[model samples]
Target chain A: MERMKMLEWVQALCFVVVDMELYLDTHPCDEEALAFYRDSVENYEKAKRKFEEMYGPLTAVKSMDCERWAWADVPLPWEGVR
Target chain B: MWTYERKLQYPVNITRPNPAMAKFIMSQYGGPDGEIAASMRYLSQRYSMDNKKVAGLLTDIGTEELAHMEMIAAIVRQLTKGCSAEELKESGLGEYYIDHTGAIWPQAAGGIPFNACEFQSKGDPLTDLFEDLAAEQKARTTYDNILRLVKDHEVADPIRFLRQREVVHFQRFGEGLRMYQEQLDSKNYYAFNPSFDK
Candidate 1:
């Protein structure tokens, strides 16, 4: 997949996790919701790892894997280049 | 506490640079009905909310507003990127250019700096939730106006998403209000401030 496309997929997966988190916050003991959230989190982590390896660090703390400070080199989220 | 998420809720990849559109969209970043105000209002109000569910709603929605704020900033930043100084000036962005130089700052389209006065944390759940409902509608209206002015699909797409969120938030706040009301004597729902008087 293209870099942007991969990044977007990671984004969509993460958003699902976040939205599920909000629902789970209100319904904390719902077993079905917990299962769904766990599944989404697993998928999101996989996608995030793929994107970070190919592109660059998505978070400041995750920049340790790069040989260089790729964080500074990557296009900012606001620049709309990534 | 909040975790730092590095992606926008929706994507904004504007291929064209339009400083004029950027100016207008900046309002959603810092205007009276902007995300900053929405986040501030809810986050602050949560401290005094009478019910756990209502407080949870405030906290979650407030956090989402922060994300929306970043989304608006992304849109404005992308819109203004790669524009010439002459084009910026002609687009009536000269005053803003002098200060921020295409860098995003929290300000309304008219250049008014973001102020806390734009929102309220009334402390009373009923009062605060009503304000929240009104705030969401006002924000939706602002987004509607933005949609009317913005023609770019890239820009409008995210704006539409943000606008839809306002509608959803309004419904949630409405439910929050109903929840709070149900806890009170129907004849005397306004009997006292549940946040303080108990």
Candidate 2:
């Protein structure tokens, strides 16, 4: 239950970061928007770290962070309801 | 230069095995207005785009469209996974089945194979942005068409999400066009390709 919650949090943060990235793309010099983007990205990174420690790395770069090879153990996206 | 991400951008856990629907949805996979073309068009056009920020927008959105393309494949795979031979044929997938044996292929519902001619990489920034805007609308329309026919709840969920993304992308491309225009000569009937002209 807790793992799902944390993963959901991480996913939500990812959504924010993705939107802010595209938003920043068009409005490049908007200082306030940039601040929001930075804040969301920082939180997204933190949430991702927590999720990786408990679950596994979301990408190849973070795969080594785990003590064991948990990279292949994680469920793929198409398997079941995520 | 793309890194492999094990998970999809959006979750697609469809439990139904409806090959008929899969056949139609496959259009969005390889059809003229599909995600594959949308991604390719933006990524290819960005090379000659004069504006740096808009070019970056193309990269980000094009990357996201790849995710959308994957989701479509996942949905089609899940839809066809447990379907029997008769079901596959009855659903009008017999021709596709003979060729791929339930495996995913990039083809339109009408069996037209994916072609690069579906999109263009015209070097002009405004021209490319306008094409992008039209592409997003066409994608949104395709999703809308899919939604009307989709009875399965699991399948409809992500389709709706993908449809909404088209509207958002159109808005962003419009903004990108405006930003590019703002940098050009204000009161002139100049007719020249800014990307190629010095």
Clashes per candidate (backbone, < 3 Å): 0, 0
Leading candidate by TM-score: 2
List, residue by residue over A1-82, the lDDT tens digit for candidate 2: 6765676688678878988899999888999999999999999899888888777888877878767777778877665553
**Positional deviation of A44 in candidate 1, in angstroms?**
1.9
Off by over 4 Å in 1: A24-34, A64-70
Could you give candidate 1's per-residue lDDT for residues A1-82 as a string of tens digits? 3977998898889888867766665567789999999999999999999888888888877889977777787766766763
Across residues B1-198, which tens digit of lDDT does each residue of candidate 1 receive?
A: 876756777788888888999999999999889999999999999999978888998999999999999999999888888888888999999999998887888999899999999999988889999999999999999999999988889889999989988987887788778877888899997888877885
TM-score of chain B of each: 0.98, 0.97
Q: lDDT for model 1, on a 0 to 1 scale?
A: 0.87
